[model samples]
Target chain A: MSNNNYVKNLIESGMRIDNRKFDEFREIEIKTNIIDRAEGSSIIKIGNTQIIVGVKLSVGEPFPDTPDEGILIVNAEFSPAASPSFEAGPPDENAIELARVVDRAIRESHCIDLKKLCIVPKEKVWNINIDIQVIDFDGNLIDAACMGTVAALKTTKIPKYENDEVDYEHREGELPLVDLPIYVTIYKIGDKLFVDPTKEEEEAADARISIATIQDGKICAIQKGGTGYFTISEIERAIEMSIIIGENLRNLFKH
Target chain B: MKEKEKLIINRKRLDGRDLYEMRKIEIQINPIKNSMGSAMFKFGKTWAIAATHGPRAAYPKWQQNPEFSILKTRYMMLPFSTWERSKPGISRRSIEISKVVNDALSNVIFLEDYPKTMIDVFIDIIEADASTRCAALNAASIALALAGVPLKDIVSSCSVGKIDGEIVLDIAGFEDNYGEVDCAVAMIPHEEKVLLLQMDGIVTKEEFKKMIMLAKEGCLKVYESQKTAIKQAFTNIIDIE
Candidate 1:
């Protein structure tokens, strides 16, 4: 059977290959502070797919427009070793998109108190680098990456600095984290919406909408991907699903 | 860490495991359907997954050998697998590990049976505490067997090393970093053939002999798990026709 048939059969029969109900997400495993050298790091596994998110801190000049605020840079690398389909090269479109969606969740939500990161207004500020890597591509990378990033940044530590120089060996304090951003993605297949599609389901999905919500179920970011169209009713239902499902994921992932 | 207690105290290593104890080993085959064969191999906190594809015609055509099939392998650790986030990609370290793993499998596989074809194995690390290369080799062996690839025997591998002046079996991640020596051994237990043998750090001749013996014992235990894993996967896979 073709990929389409495989998915259709499952939908017709109910549940996924792993026997998960259509609306249910895969089992998630999160481990934070796995990287000692980096200020913060997390490894998240959604079913078989896994992603590593690390936060690196450095001193730099803040953007002119945001002179007193800290900077957040999100970078993603899809390793060829993650899957046969991935190539050895710079970040591809998929990687760039993964980073952007995750970045939007934290940035747009103003999860971090950036102004406190400024050492001197317009002169020096903390440049926070978030690097995400898809180490296993079993699917559902976006949700996992977002969780990893949020968890990592939550645990980030700012290095101690004195006399205008950072002491790389000593950590002074934790980053000023104010809110938690959670992402929930729902994939559409043959009119049905599902949470956390496996790689095969993902390949056959028509379209997917990702919603990022902070505390109190407020939507902060929305991204729609894939070539398929979504009905107005479907979008509404998905947003509802995002809030309900995103809450559960966030609670379970709490540090 | 105290000098004596950091590694070994009363012959028990960190995590309170005996010097001869191996990590808890678990294997799940065919976790993903896209590949011909796949396995999720877990050795305690160190976890890895391997997938095998091919015996298909070699790509680019020119890479095919008329008399034997080519085996391609890639090994990578997740950035969060270690204390520090490692850069993801095929680094010099991974390349070397992949090459050696390929070499270890070459002798056990009946590559000559499938001429003008290629078999690709990819290993992805989820969490690594140490001896990932050996774990990859063991996982790849199960994946190949699950894919119905012809094998002389399923290969089993393990690492032995010296910590606190005693040779130990199945070194964990931290022991690998702080230990004095590491010797990885891969074998076909029934035939008792050493397909791969590599080591690093300083060792005396007597210690080398002892390490190899301990490694062989560890490999045998791993071989039993590989056989049972492949058998279990097939038992659930009933014939359709």
Candidate 2:
């Protein structure tokens, strides 16, 4: 189905599929330390959607290009178990896009001081692997996953090392990553713009734009997806809305 | 004593657990605002998340049973969850586990209360160590509880394994791989009822009996932990009652 009528009905009523107003986001809930084995982990909930992110660390040779800095890899998997549409195999394009967008937000925002991950100069650096698993898909997985990732990273503590071995038993201090970055996704349905579209709105909307912002209000990354195109003015409007949402989210991580 | 020395001298055994041993266990729960319930579980690094959606309508004509509510389960692991990520869709292992979890849970749920409705349980494993399937079953039970889905019982589960020729409770990833026998059980403590019982590898009937006893002990311990967590979750909220 084209969902044209559904989109038109929602737009005409000045409401979203989930009955949210134009600029409102879905309800969000965050919980950390849900994964006991992960160095840092968080589960994020946006309405009916759920994403779990686990952060694990190990020592490995840094990339030759970024030998002085640590390496961060973000992998997002939308399992078939999450939804009926999701197929069995390697992550398809949707999963890849989700991971890349989230990766860019964190990396571009310079949330973690990659240099601090260095264990022994150019020889070894902490390889941080962020694994994101989508356990349920109601809608708007990107925002939920990104938020969960950032929260997990914020709570992460790189264990102290001495004499080429991790001091697992003894405790040293924690080094919190520097900046906190957040992402907000907006969907355009007809002439109306909606923040944090639900699965229904997401299915009905013509085009979607996700904008990630750092605390400084700088655009870290922007991805425009779906079949529809937006006017430059709409893009500007989305950015402004994202900034407001990002600021609100920034306050959330402060605690 | 001399036989003990022989086992430890080379630090190797038919089953790998040292004396006074247990397996690694991991637990996680994601509160998905979108879903009715959600949780992740890891046993010896075998990871799975259970998500529940709806006491909604029953779909497809034949699948519905009017006398009792339906419990539909899908158990799957992402390709990346294992050392080698498997195919994404329903694998044989997942299908089997789904059936096992469904059977385990059906015994505890009062399905007759919600006739004609359907409760869907989806479990996805992001990684596997050992006892992943059993851990997933435990996680589903907790997630359902968190969702506030009424049930007649709280199902708790764990695994027991034999290593170094002795029974050990809760096999960790390493111990499970090298252990002689692995047995997973799900039970309702209040009823003292066993829902699911599965075993693999090697063990005599006597050893199997011992393993069941040990697994039950582990299950009780896990049940206590689950209670603590549930209490803690609700502690801060104002009690309506």
Candidate 3:
């Protein structure tokens, strides 16, 4: 309790243990096309938090609700080596939440233009599977995972499909993208809110909100987590912070 | 599927509601006699029942925490609840919804009061149309409150969607099938704080804010019905005495 109070007091007094500004994110480094065997892959590191995302394409049937659109499935795994809290088994709620949030951002934004992936409408559409792995333990996994997923998708190329057969030896054109979505998460410890929290800071935080925005400051997805609440003004501030940070992060992909 | 029928015509939904209107809601308390607390909440065509059990001993000893109690929420949709038969059993979708609903209520309940204990809330979707999660949350919150669990406030929930370039409240039926976006919100009304928020689909930032405002108003209305149901339940008990 005292440790929690100590962290909260410091944050409320306009200071972070890491000396970062309230809205500042840790140094981000995103590397794409990290795996040659995979169709697309990326490794992203925000401070000590590292995540890798790889995209795999397969032929499958589309869901009934979206018969004309291709299928997109996101799966995430937290390696036991990443953190002591994570176990070596199937995904728990945290892992599921991480994957779902990233999936919502990508799927909701219509970034992939799923229509183009459709080979035969409901019969034989290209199913895009994004697998995210947590390689290091830190905080701000959501932001890092989202960035890595986008990076991987940006570098993705469709596998050659001819005569109802996928040819691994051949390559097709680049993956069509409609818009780029970037996620920015803000953690609230006390009255103060900050971005890109470390593990220690995350432990002391009361609540956190993540917003995923597209190029024109449009919000595609949102999630509020933790056992604390945020007042109306706090939420508003978080949204503004998200938009500014998202724009800056989105700019990295232009190159 | 039928010639791309319009969802909204003449500024009104097919169900005869305005853009900012929600479905008629109904609440019933203690629907399950043997449970600690239980309630059924209905939003037009959608219905859900939630039951709360235990601040009793924690199970699986390792899962117990020494400092505070734990809250677990399980959300399920019956096979017959939807238009088509959904496979019976816990799916990934249910697991994710359970986690979010648990988070939405964990803050309100004073779990620290009962160390080494756990509270389990189970919600079953009895019928479906749209906004099922929102309905499930509304039922679960009332069940927790009725169970005599110490709480800061009751959580109310609703969903907002955009259809044909217009934002509408409490999507159902045709609007839900063709809506461009669906955003579900759960909040503490008096505190003006949101507890659970999940959204999918596309909307600009301005439209998003408008949806939040509309959701808050919708939740407030749900809160009124909840309060009334609780009062009626207590009154019935007094008459039984």
Best by DockQ: 3
Q: After superposing candidate 2, which stretches have Cα over 4 Å from the reference?
A: A2-4, A167-175, B1-241
Alpha-carbon deviation at B185 in model 3, angstroms = 1.1
State residue A66's C-alpha deviation in candidate 3, in Å: 2.9
Q: Tens-digit lDDT track for model 3 on A1-255? A: 777677788898999878999888888899999987788999999999999999988889988777878889999999999999889999998999999999999988889999888888768888899999999978998889998999999999888999889986677878888889888998997678899988888889989999999988888888888878888678888999999999999998898
Going through the candidates in order, what fraction of the true interface contacts does each contain? 0.00, 0.00, 0.84
Regarding DockQ, does 2 or 3 come out ahead?
Answer: 3
Model 3 residue B182 CA deviation (Å) reads 1.1
* Model 1 misplacement above 4 A: B1-241
Number of the top lDDT candidate: 3
Instruction: Put down candidate 2 lDDT per residue, B130-199, tens digits, no spaces.
Output: 7776778877887888777888767888877776677777766656655555666677654445555544
What are the per-residue Cα lDDT tens digits for candidate 1 across A17-124? 788887788778888899989999999999889999999999989887689888999989998999999999987667776777787778767889988898988799
TM-score computed on alpha carbons, candidate 3: 0.96
- Model 1 clash pairs? A36-B83, B129-B173
Q: Which ten residues in a row have the lowest lDDT in candidate 2 chain B?
A: B1-10
B1-241: candidate 3 lDDT, tens digit per residue: 3467788899998889999988888787898987899989989889999999989889988889998999989999999998889999888888889988899999889999989999999999989898999999999988998999999889999999899889999989667778888888899976789888888877887888888888889989988888788778754321110
lDDT of 2 at A227: 38
Estimated TM-score per prediction? Answer: 0.52, 0.51, 0.96
lDDT of each: 0.80, 0.72, 0.88
